[model samples]
Target chain A: MSGAGEGPGHGLGGRPTTGARTRSIAEAAWAAAGRDGERNGHGRTRLQWLMARFGRGTVIGIPYIWLLLFFLLPFLIVLKISFAEFRIGLPPYTPLLEWIEGGYLQIKLAFGNFLFLLDDPLYVVAYLNSLKVALVSTLIALLIGYPMAYAIARASPTWRAVYLLLVILPFWTSFLIRVYAWIGILKNNGLINNALISLGLIDSPLPLLNTEVSLYIGIVYSYLPFMVLPLYATLEKMDIALIEAAADLGCRPFKAFLTVTLPLSMPGIVAGSMLVFIPAVGEFVIPDLLGGAGTLMIGKVLWSEFFNNRDWPVASAVAIAMLIFLVIPIVVFQYYQHKHAERAEES
Target chain B: MTDTLVQGTHSASSRPEGSRPGAVLRRAEARPIIEIQDVVKTFGDFVAVDQVSLTIREGELFALLGGSGCGKTTLLRMLAGFERPTAGRILIGGQDMTQVPPYDRPVNMMFQSYALFPHMSVEANVAFGLRQDSLPKAEIRDRVRQMLDLVQLGPFAKRKPHHLSGGQRQRVALARSLAKHPKVLLLDEPLAALDKKLREQTQLELVGIQERVGTTFVVVTHDQEEAMTMADRVAIMDSGRIIQVDTPHALYEYPNTRYVAEFFGTVNMFQGQLIEDEPDHILIRSDALANPVYVGHGISARGGATVWVALRPEKLAISRVQPDSPHNWDQGIVEDIVYLGGISTYHIRLDSGALARVTTQNLERMAEPDITWDDRVFVSWRHDNTVVVTG
Candidate 1:
């Protein structure tokens, strides 16, 4: 069956009918058919042969299959569960479809779970709070990371390596451990409060822990390296002569930075902002540990619905809603990113 | 013969500065617009520039010619106020600019890489300097248009730097640097990045623009031909010091040392002790020459002192038969011949094992030359064509 597809590929590749070339082509076709046969039935080898006519199709199809199995399949299952009714059973959810006696099918979808979210103000507040936290933390990370990246990029080659290592040094430790370490520094009786008290800057310990400030500090600290690395990659590639040319044309140092350095590093800024903002919106650890009980975020609400309340259907609905909410911004961001990339390539 | 040599040196030394090429003196005397006074720059234990002083007249195109790491760039940077000299003062238009920052200094530079802002359009890049000065919007727009037209990049004004070709980007950079109308314009290897044909064309354009603007221009370049083509006066620099500064013609004709002579063009050196120092001529006897070589130039060196007589390759004439001249002539066998279309250079191996190069113009086109490999020929130069250096 594979031999049928090889006829056209042989002509297209213009491969000589040497023993080695023929053997390699045969092996590739066999391997592709073997993989396809495992998924579809073995009797469908002729179909696989037709699909494999263009050898490049098989190579391109591998990544599509991987994405389907790993990402789309799991997502569809969660989406299916979101429409099922919650029940105390082995699977803990009612079947979405049932066959009636008279050859008719009845589909039972528990859209009440989705309606319950709109009815309850808690979920809406949690989503709003998540977006606010994510936006604020990303801004803080950008503000701190930009200068460090610029300084590292402008540093001499030997010193540049040292500074870059320092930026990545926090990653050497486990991420949870790094987050936990921040707790000690931000607590009411932590080193910062103790030092401030000793310096007479404060009479007593401030409410430093279990607050939005602490949560922001933790999020910014963890995601700073992500911001700095990308910004440095862009800033390091920038020509320093651009700044000199600006200065030579009567621009002051700071104005030169705003005009030349800042605009040129926009790609890095966008990348770094997305890197910090995306994961931060759904981040559970930092807010769970550092945020006050009053602080509302969707990740915490989803966690409570699944583990504490044991409402699998509602939890899945909440998760689907959160994904939909996140998808809007992500799609918009990706559209702009694609447009920017095309513009850059054209220029 | 020695008297003529002394008279040549005296007349050359007394040649008025106003008579030099590209010299524009308002009065009989030239006024120095830019003064680099005993400038010394050191970089962390390395002396990048030794104590150097130079006076650039108004509207003169000057060139600092040197190889890599020769301090020419350091000197140019100092003039641009990018690097502050560790020891000396820089004065422009009679105002001390030693302590002034680059932004405040009335000078601008065109970088060698043509660093046009990639994000900005050609017109915006040209307007950048004017915007920095907080100029009025209408005036900035007018200046940008005028400058872009000056570089003939008006059509490309709306295009980003990456969209423009290399030569167009260079012109945009030139427009941007000149938009501010700086008192002194420093060009760092302005034509270095251009291709051969474009570079030759741009060289003339650069000279024309400089003359039209009448800005005191200082260009730093390692290419001798580039310096010779564009500059009125060329400063030959080596290591961390200036070896000699003179007009291009003078530097080529009367190089003061072996370094300057060899640096400017190809030269054959005959090292010998000075045998006689008569009023009209001097004689140098070297093993490279079968007989003593006569140079119609008397140096300040005493007789018996070691000196070198440098002869340009083009100055030496090769003949199939021995010449009647007794001095400044040698017989050698042609070891190699390089034909370069209009001129052919012959490498001759003399009895003393010294290889001398003689270049002659091909006046008539022939498939075969009169002289070929292994042909014994006489190489001779007129005495007045030779330069004698005692250092």
Candidate 2:
């Protein structure tokens, strides 16, 4: 190809070609070609550089965009609605921002909803009641789940698989169905009352359903697997030799568990507790289905405000306040996760 | 004071009324710290340890050496009170400890994996056993410091097990097990995880620690070299049975069976029939040899009884010309030569197609080859070097 290009320049011009003249002409042609090649190479590299940048941008930007569109955008919309005034309309709330004449923006936000929640004792009681219920149910779930997780982790390989399957088997049925099943078992004419009355332990059917006790049972039963799964993962990966080492060092079996097994499974405990606690605080179905009028929970109040009262602004305000209240625990959970990841990396 | 009190009670309880005088004398001379009497451990249909019996002397470093399924670890676990014998008994320091739980037994074990608590610092790990006894805080601190110093890990006491090197973690495990001053210390392949250089150094360190503490240490190991280097006496185990127990030197030089001889090191065996048996000397005619081989000592075997002569590779010498020795010599052609830095091994093939290995030290540097491949050579050994076995 180079020879063919050179043939046109050297052979067509037939004036007595001297050595110096031929060399000068070849050098000019070479310089021109070098300039063209440089331009082409630069353009190619520039395109490649942009392509590489786009590749990295896609990897990182996609997740950020997903969070923004699906999570952050919805949260901002709720926040905006929380500030708007309530009105009888198709959307049931007025817009907080409006454009006036001369292209000037006017903003109107109502603080009355937040002020009304603070003034009303019912909202305050519901918040406190929800927190108390969540705390007690999480404790119950932890107590029942820890021993189950430890047993499954220490079981033989074949038995371990079976135990894990049993732990997760409740998920096969619909969650709402499981919650509804608890009502039948815990009601006055249900299994527990009937069995107790038939055994002559009770003179009549006691009021078991539509009570705080039923709420606690439903929450614990539904969230028990969440508590056990993370705990099992941590306990199963634990080295059994540590417990044996403790026993060999003169520790009794129970003390060995406290000193070695319990301390080492702290990460799992924290993870499992967060998983159960976060969801239990906002629990609505169990409270609505099993809780009586005495059990005033924020989730049921929020549901009533949105659907029964047709109060969108107050419901949005309630949701925003609940999120704000939960931020501290969520931050604490994130800090724990971060610390655990760092510890893992160091080891 | 507590040690003496415990020992007194143990002896008073275990000693029979008017015990044999010989038994009392033996106890006074060198008491058996741990006695494993006819212990048998069976898992379902498989017998892990079959009626194994051994007595480890006080302040002795004993090793159980065997291959993987030979029940060495199971025997050690029994000593540690981790496994209950299906039959027979285990006694520690003259006390019946067969029914005792591990936490109550006066024994500690250094696990093979080092089993250091990842969540605790080295000082805490060493102090765990001491704390279990509810000792005074001041005493626990002093004892933990002393153990850390003994292991040369004073600077690393504040570090967790994961932060320390493998050798350092191993020392922590050793110090933790030794901290409580238990009557017996069991080590299960303690140095198996360390590299070769670290393993050799740690083996010597282990021996030193055991001697200084005067604790009866029963180490279970599959590496023959490690067992021989670290133990005062080695017990070779095979197929859930104690095959032989002897000092390392005696076990190597005078192995009673072909299994013991081969397990300790490489040995070449010749199957033969005993043709002549005298009081001082014996003759065996082997098919691998052109003539009958002679030994200095005789065994009580009838004529024409099948026997085996086990010869170690290092004991045999190879030469190009036939030696002046009248017996214990064979003519063969060198097939392969492995030149190790310190020693050279020559594989020679006899006329009967039997292979024999002869190893010689490179005492002098050789610029030119003295023996190369495919050279006809004679391999000979002293009559005392050959061990005869009749099964």
Candidate 3:
């Protein structure tokens, strides 16, 4: 039993919370303090609570296990597959590198596949061609998409919703079918040529089919929405009174657009460019279906190595090289995303 | 300009406040700059501006006062040439600007939202107008620097608009609008974005800036206090019509109608039948009140003709005994008493169930108010304190 001094009237000594309940309240305070770093809380907490909750089964252990099972496991498999030996005469055999006899290791692990790829210049050409196409397509898409996005932003509310729906509807349709439709349109005797000839605008069918131009058309068609959506999102968020303010400040409409509207839309432009460029670089369906055998891209080479030559090890090396090459942009994009989060919080 | 009539004569559309002795003294010898004719704007079915005609004199700060849904903003937009009037004309320096677009108009506006270009630095926002005129790059830079220095934003010249405070942004917008040196500058609720304290300070600063710049500033605002505190002339609007255009003192002291009196400020009004019409005063018998009221303004009030008598809360005096008052007398029970620091207001419940609000000065605090809640007392005002109004 406690005395009257332990009651709430006597402050901490008198109150139940100050006395026995003090310890429980402290525990509750600690519990309430954090949620992110915590495992059970899971969504959000601080480092201390996370550390406190972390036992032998927690802290680094669970995360390590999850990371190993999901992320590192796939990479390990790819690494092993990449180094395993394969030959035309020998059954594709595999081995791990270890310093067994001499000071040097790697008895079966081969660097010959990468060496052959470097010596052959065709692989280099393919990589360069893929980069060129993706870059060109991204530029074209941005040029077309920005105005379209701006129009959507400036349109009335009903039209904005309708336009946005139309822009994204292409994504819902079969992507392969869209590419095939472009193929039909770009063919030598297809609808575009037929229409021009019928109108006598062109003397005859222009050579549009199976060229770099056709490949470009297909890529831009597929990725235009990707560019537009981000631009639209950014444009929509811009305040309209700012434009009026610029005009009030004596700026003409065009000048207001150049200084206020255009610069404000840069983040959207960059985001759209990244979205279009990343996928277009890896695209196989468009070039293969539209350009045929003339389009020598990394995807085609990768397919050839794995299928036509049955060179599994070489294909794996090419895959690993492509992944390494891609890491630069991915890391940049991730950094941008992190910064955007910080901006969101600050605003 | 020397060539334009704007610098010599006030436009014919403006209400003549020439007789007020202080109006001439307050103007400091500048003339009218902007002349707006019977300008009317109709958007489909809704009439946005209804034959609104007014002239803003050179170097004078004029305010268009109204609540939202009233046509003050539409009238301002017409002056800016952002909106085209369906009927009538706008003359800036005697040049017809009815169809001219906003960019080509000599008048510049400061938007209520500040509308600072988010992408541009403070200098760039101010430079935009100069650049449009195709000024040399060096000249543009020099002018931008001068404008920024005027607003005390020289240290923040390179900083983007989002970095500035609301008041700072307002100044930037103001500087930018003034940078072009238009014949007239228009403002649309310019200080609406700031907090009450900031808004008041900015209002005074804006009026001071108007004086220094010597450009006709025509502002549109919903706040009567904003209109009263900032503008040399206040135009009260209601339902797409200009009700009264006068100096702030004139508007409060002598209103033309019941609506004008009530809209421009708080008014205690009683709908009455005209009982007597003397040379300098009007007498009206109201159904809601027990006594007839004598208003100072002479009105053509015939017997049985309905009219209104308006007395501001501050104009009404409350006491235990009649204080030799002449306008009207009433016995009321003090219903609600609110102490508002600087002043206290009393809601006196009359026998007719109507409430008379009386604001007494807190000049002496030696004792509590002589009357308490539910205490029956006399409320009265002098003839000069009341005005005759017709809806």
Per-residue alpha-carbon lDDT of candidate 1 for residues B1-391, written as tens digits (9 for 90 to 100)? 1343234334433444423654433421557889989999999999989989988887878899999999999999998888999999999999999999989989999999988898888889999889988899999999999898778788888998889888888889889989999988999999999999988767767776776678888999999988877787889999889999888788888999999999998899989989999878899998789878887766798899999889999999999878887788998999999989899999999878999999989888755688899999989888899899876
Clashing residue pairs in candidate 2 are none
Considering DockQ, where higher is better, how would the candidates rank from best to worst? Answer: 1, 2, 3
Model 2 chain A: which ten-residue window has the lowest total lDDT?
A1-10
True contacts kept of 3: 0.60
Clash number for each model: 7, 0, 11
Q: Clashing residue pairs in candidate 1, if any?
A: B1-B280, B1-B281, B2-B279, B2-B280, B2-B281, B3-B279, B3-B280
Tell me the DockQ of each model, to 2 decimals.
0.66, 0.62, 0.41
* Chain A (candidate 3) TM-score to true chain A: 0.74
Per-residue lDDT over B1-391 for candidate 2, one digit per residue giving the tens place of the 0 to 100 score: 1343234334433434213344434534678898899999999999999989998888777899999999999999888888899999999999999989889999999999988998899999999999999999999999999998878888998998889889999999999999999998999999999999988767777776775688889999999998877777789999899999877777888888889988998999999999899988999999998667899877988888999989999999888888776678998899999999788899999988999999988887755668899999989988888899886
Q: Whose DockQ is greatest here?
A: 1
Residues B1-391, candidate 3, lDDT per residue (tens digit)? Answer: 1212222222321434433656757674666577778888898999888888887778777899999989999899888877888998888887888888787788888888777776567888888889888899999988888877666778899887767888889989988998888899989999888999988766766765666678888999999998877777889998898999888888988899887888878889888888787777678888777777876656765667888878899988888885564548887899999889778999999888888999988888686777889998888888778787767
lDDT of 2 by residue, A1-347 (tens): 13323322442343324466554544544444445544334554322333343535555666888999999999999999889889998788998889999998999898888887899998888888888998898899999999999999999999999999999999999999999998889888999999999999999899889988889999999999999999999999998888888988889999999999998899889888888888888889999999887989889899999999989888988888888877878899899889889888888
- Overlapping backbone residue pairs in candidate 2 total 0
